[model samples]
Target: MTRSVALFATCLGDQLWPEVVEATVAVLERAGCRVTFDPAQTCCAQPAFNSGYHDEAKAVARAFVEVFERADAVVAPSGSCTAMVHRYPELFRDEPDWRARAEAVAHKAFELSAFLVRELGVVDLGARLSARVAWHDACHALRELGVHDEPRRLLRAVAGLELVELRTGESCCGFGGTFAVKFPELSTAMLDHKLSGLDDRVDVLSAVDSSCLMQMRGRLQRQGSRVRAMHLAEILASR
Candidate 1:
């Protein structure tokens, strides 16, 4: 039986990097899953939730649950958004109605790499990309979802791809949703620490979340760093 999956082409990936959305579909199709793009999807409402606006967050969460319930599973190319769906339930636990729905959705949401390895049984896409690359372990995906190894496993499977060790492998890019805007100086200081660790030997720095990449790229460009920001789906879709 062909498993059907819903694509959460998140707000960031949808607006900033449409190619990542396309690449995600390509990767899923290559793995033999029937992918459906739910145009009705919007921000996972993480910004609202993180800002302590549960009511506003629930409005979008309700729409998401309705749209994704039909699919056998929901797959997102973004680690942060997937993590939100998976982890946001705790925030709603005080409210019984939202808590149950949040639990049901969290159980179904899967990050791209996890979905590929666990649900689709795809070890690799037989993809080839020649570039020295490093990965950023976004806070939610790494700590919350325990997704540290899955992305690396898939990256290693790509022919000619080299995964380098970032000096502070577990450091945050400092994008923390509204955190960047609220404390720009502190955020940049943290980002500077993370970027200074890069050797510039890598041609691309890839992460599961675009928000992380965007912040990193801004600082890297300011310092004239040679590395370019890329998303994992973009790397996997590489020929």
Candidate 2:
């Protein structure tokens, strides 16, 4: 049976990182999975939820549940957004109707890396990118989602890739949605620590969420660092 998968490319990825979405589809197809893009998919409402707009978040969440209700699985390029979809149902625990919808959506969503490794079971996907690399663990992906190793597993499986450990591998880059705007000093301080860990040892930095990579790239560019930031999907699509 062909495993049908829905690609839930988040807003940033849809708007900016089309390559990531393309790579995500490429990897899944190469693994013999039938992937479809749900063009109606929107922001997973993480920004609204994190900003305390629960009602607006629920509207978006409900839309997603209704849209992808019949697909075999919903896969996303972002751990943060996927976690939001997976966990957003609990936000409406008091409302039985909305709560049920949230639970349905969450149960089907999967991070691209996690799905690639665990569900597809295809390692050594013929990816080839020769660069020293480090991974950033977004707050939602690390703490909320508990998805720490899948990306590394897939990265290591890439034929010509070298995955290096960041000095503080699990530290948050402080781009907690609005955290950077709310507390710029603390945000940069945290990112500075993350950037300092590079130490001429890596050529590229990758993460599941493009937001984190963009944030890191902004800081690295300001400091004139040559390290390139890429999404996990883009890296995996390498040949």
Candidate 3:
């Protein structure tokens, strides 16, 4: 059976890390899903929502709901964005009709790892990657979405991959969307603390969210660190 999945190309994934988008499609297709992309899709308004702009966030959230409503399932490469989508009903609390629609969209939306492991019942995609990798738990994915073990389960099943534990794997990488911008020094301080936990033995650092990777990768590059940061989708799609 072929499940129709609407690939919600997250703002960062589409603009900054398109490879993650492609990798997500490849992995979903490998799982017997027919993936579709809609240009009508845009940001899930997480930035505005996080910045305390409910009206603006609601507008973007409505657009997202309308765009992905018809798909059998909507999956995003970003756990943060997926978490934002799941909160659509709260955003539309004043409008009952929109709230109902938002609830439906929320029920259908899922992060990539969760959809693969929980919905499809697939832990392994026969991916091969010869590297010592450490998985970072994106705050929204772990705390908001409760997706701590699914990604680890999937990574453990990958052939030629050695999954190592990061001392600060469960801590925030300090990329709290606008939080970094609002508090630069505090964000940098938090990120530096997280980086210290990256063991020198790690060839690659993997996380379910590209936003976290982007933040960590920038700091790694600035400091001339050799460890590379990659999204879990890219690692899982590796063949």
Off by over 4 Å in 3: none
> What digit string (tens of lDDT, one per residue) describes model 3 on residues 1-239?
88899999899889888889999999999999999999998799999998999988888888998998888899999899999999999889989999999999999999999999999999989999999998889999999899988999999999999998889768899999998989989999999999899888999999989999989999999999999999999999998
Lowest summed lDDT across 10 adjacent residues in model 3 is found at: 164-173
Model 2 CA lDDT for position 84: 86
Tell me the lDDT of model 3 at 74: 96
Question: lDDT for every model?
Answer: 0.86, 0.85, 0.92
Top candidate on lDDT is: 3
Q: What does candidate 2's lDDT look like per residue over 57-174, in tens digits?
A: 8888788787777788999888889888877668778889878877877888888878877777777688999988888887777777777888888899887688988887788887
lDDT digits (tens) for residues 1-239 of candidate 1: 57788899999889988998999999999888898987888888899988888889878877887777667788888788998888657877787887787788889999898889877778789889999998888888888878888889999999999998799779988889899999999999899888867776889999888889999998888878789998999999999
- Report clash pairs, candidate 3: none
Better of 1 and 3 by lDDT: 3
Error (Å) of candidate 1 at residue 116 is 0.9
TM-score of each: 0.95, 0.96, 0.98
Candidate 1: where are CA atoms >4 Å away? none
lDDT of 2 at 173: 83
